[model samples]
Target: MAQPIIEFKNFGFQYDAQAEPTLYNIDLAIQPGERVLIAGPSGSGKSTIASCINGLIPFSYPGRCTGSLTVDGVDAPNASIFELSKHVGTVLQDPDGQFIGLTVGEDIAFALENQCVAQPEMKQTVERVARLVDVENLLEQEPHALSGGQKQRVSLAGVMVDDVKVLLFDEPLANLDPAAGKQTIELIDQVQQKTGATVIIIEHRLEDVLWRSVDRIVLMGEGRILADTTPEALLAGNQLAENGIREPLYITALKYAGVSLEAEKKPAHVDTLRLTEQDKAAVRTWYQQTVARPQAPAAAPLLEVKDLCFGYSEGVTNLRDVSFTLNEGDMVSIVGRNGAGKSTLAKLICGFETPRSGSVWLNGRNLEGDTIKERAAHIGYVMQNPNQMISQSLIFDEVALGLRTAKLPEDEVERRVNEALTICGLYPFRKWPVSALSFGQKKRVTIASVLVMQPKVLILDEPTAGQDFRHYTEIMEFLRSLNQKGYTVIMVTHDMHLMLEYTSRALVFNQSRMIGDLTPAELLCDSTLVEQAALKETSLFTLAQKCGIQPPEAFVQHFIDYDREVRDKWQTV
Candidate 1:
């Protein structure tokens, strides 16, 4: 048998500033040419493990370490980051933040150039790695000008040029659209197969990661390794839900239909799952017997956009003839590929950009004359990047900034800010420094900052992007409650499940055009629209088809309705 390329033997680590060890007695091993997924909720210590593997924990983070860890036959804790860099190359969550050169070629060659390699050798190496990542043609383009998926590929090329033995990807799918994300996963598989490199992926999107086969899954929680097993074995159990990780939608659907998840059935991947006659019968019976609740009546229009046309440059359209009405007490999702103008639409409505020849009306009042500040009174926009919105050092101060800016009384400001923090599940950390929080927590802080403004219409851009399923549920449920209380909510997001579960209607955009306006189920069930918008069909649809359920869209909607009913009951309890 081949030796383990990476091994951790009863390892433990504690940050200098932290009171307790973040990782506890972790023992793991990864063989060469293996693909393993590390999954857990926020604060699960999975990131800490990544830091240790990359020689960042004891080096950059300055922590006390116990036990031993090795990567590529070198001791990790005692190794310099530069030494480990030769063996481990990481692609970070935000590909834009990792760019260091002006052009794609320069960025990929930066590491080699730093080593003082000859120009001729460097050029050959850069072209080879760029071709490996399928980015050879994009070498001359500015890294920032590339699309999200293209940027990610550039990031991968930048690392692959090093000829590292292990590839570490930190949440590579977080900012990508569905099609882009799928393509990224496929690219990672191809790169791994050709190079025979060990791959370690740290991600919260378990279902998406499973789109490509993985050798094993390491589930962690509370600073402990909960389970390390094959994906098939892991998905056949309750560890994911117990640890606050979201299982695949189809798995949940199967469980809902009382279909047992036998290991032999291969529940890990939808395409490979071996369904039985009894399982099909069970799903069919459940669908036939289940009664879907009637959808709520449409509310009166509270906001409207007509003939909206916009572009950053003259004669080049980013959004064209786009129009939609947002009714009072409605929750809708705007979904599409990145740069499909979803965020542009939100910006136009919020008065950040003036439409070329369009108008916005709120409550029969023309908002064309409203300034950005004036629009704030009726509309709240929470940006996707928290760093762009946060201006305070502490969480409490940040959340209260909007309220104080409005000249609310100090006592009232405190009341509203605390309430918003509670709703966002950030009240416990209200006194903490903003820099001390995780990316997900910072995202919640931004949401809380907006929630305190008490706008009539709330527009959130990827509100749940960096969050775990637990926090995602909390924020969405709070938004649902707000909708019930007459706040119209619009979410610009790439999360298909969020659209299917939390939203009643979806506006699909593609190529700067509003392509489809329909229910979430209807949008996902139509293959043409799904493909056009770069959206993937929900696994629940595939499950329905496998079970011989007629009109798969109904079954999808029925599952959503039934799931929401159960969730609502749980909330009431």
Candidate 2:
């Protein structure tokens, strides 16, 4: 048997300023060359454990540590971060936060330079790692100027430049498009095979991570390991759902069909999971039972863009000749690969960017003449990074800022603030200090702040990025409620589940152009569109295909309809 490369024995950790420990007594072991996934909902202490493995808990976070923890045989608490860096390389959740170099090549070479390696050797190592991560062309480009997905890849290249024995990735797929996300998982597998490193991935996208086989999954909740087992055994039961973690959609579909997999010992990979004839029949029966809901005719357009063209500078256009109309009460999603101009289009709609030669109309009023603040009355834009949007120290004050700025009466401001907080599930934390909140909590603060303004059209960029499953549902349900009340909601996101489960329409962008505008089902069903837009087919679609269903697209459509029906029923109840 191989010795454990990473081990935790009765380990506990608490921040110095907190009254309670963030991590409970944890006992885990990952042998050399093993790949492990640390998964949990937001605030579940999975990140804290990753910090411990990277020697950031004691050295940087000022945390109290108890029990033994070791990484690559080095005592973690006592070892300096510099010493731990020799054995462990960490890619943080925020790639921007981890970058220090101006250019991609410089960033990747920073670690090598710290070791005082000769310039020639450093250059060679940087080039090799850049090739490994497929960022060779981005070497000379500024890291900060790159897209979110590109920045993530640069971060990976920087960490892989060093020959570390253990690699830690924190939410690596959080900002990636589905296609890029799939490629990232494949790259991780290749890196593991080539380096024989003990790789630990901390992420919430379990299905994406499950694209490649993992030795074990260390499930955490409130700082303790809930289940440390193989994916097959883990998904064989309802533990994940019970713990507020999202099970794969296919598995959920199977459960909905009343199919049991308790007797099966095979892996849960959709391609490999063999269903009995009865199971197949049950799935078909469920599909047959699903009734498609009638679509209500769309209201008149609330926001319209015509012949819109925008460029950051001469010869660099981000959006060109873009045209779209969004109707009142419509829930729409804009999706594409990173740097595909999805966000640029949102900014244009919200009056953050001036068009070169086009116009935006909101309810027959021209938005080109309106200032950003003036446009705020009709459009609220929640930025992708919560840090950029948050301004106040207290959660309540933050939410109330926009309302107060509008000179609303104090009583009205208070009422609106409280209501927005309640809707975003941040009411209990209204009085809490913003600095004390987790990333997801802070995201809710920004959302509540926008919701208080009561804009006619709400545009959110990756609204559920850092959120947990419970919060994702809560936020989406809130948006659904707003949609029912005739508010227009638009989201720019990479989450296929969100696109399919929430939005009725999708506008697909590629290279600063809208390539396809159709229902989410149509976009997903058309393989060419999915590939051209850099999106992946949903696992539910794959499940239907594996079940030998004819015209898998119809099954996918039925599932979506069924899901919406169930959600509506839950909301009414």
Q: In angstroms, how far off is 475's CA in candidate 1?
A: 1.6
Off by over 4 Å in 2: 263-267, 292-294, 394-396, 408-444, 568-573
How much lDDT does each candidate structure score?
Answer: 0.91, 0.87
TM-score, every prediction: 0.95, 0.94
Each candidate: RMSD? 2.1, 2.4
Residue range 298-374, candidate 2, lDDT tens digits: 58978998988999999998988888888888899999988889999998988888889889999987888899998
The runs of at least 3 residues in candidate 1 whose Cα sits more than 4 Å from the true structure, single-residue gaps closed, are 292-294, 393-400, 407-445
Which candidate should be chosen as best, given lDDT against the real structure?
A: 1
Q: Distance (Å) between predicted and true CA of 290, model 1?
A: 3.1
Candidate 1 lDDT over residue span 1-573, tens digit each: 799999999999999989999999999999999999999998899889999999887988998999999999999999999999999999999999999999999999999989999999999999999989999999999999999999999999998888999999999999999999999999999999999999999998899999999999999999999999999999999999988999999999999889999779999999889999999999988887656586688678899988899999988899999888878888999999988999999999999998988898999899988899889978999887789999999999999997788899999999999898887788899899999987767877887887788788999999888678987887788778778867789999999999999998999999999999999998999999999999999998899889988799999999999898888788889
Error of 2 at 310 (Å): 1.2
As a TM-score, model 1 comes out at 0.95
Candidate 2 pairs with clashing backbones: none
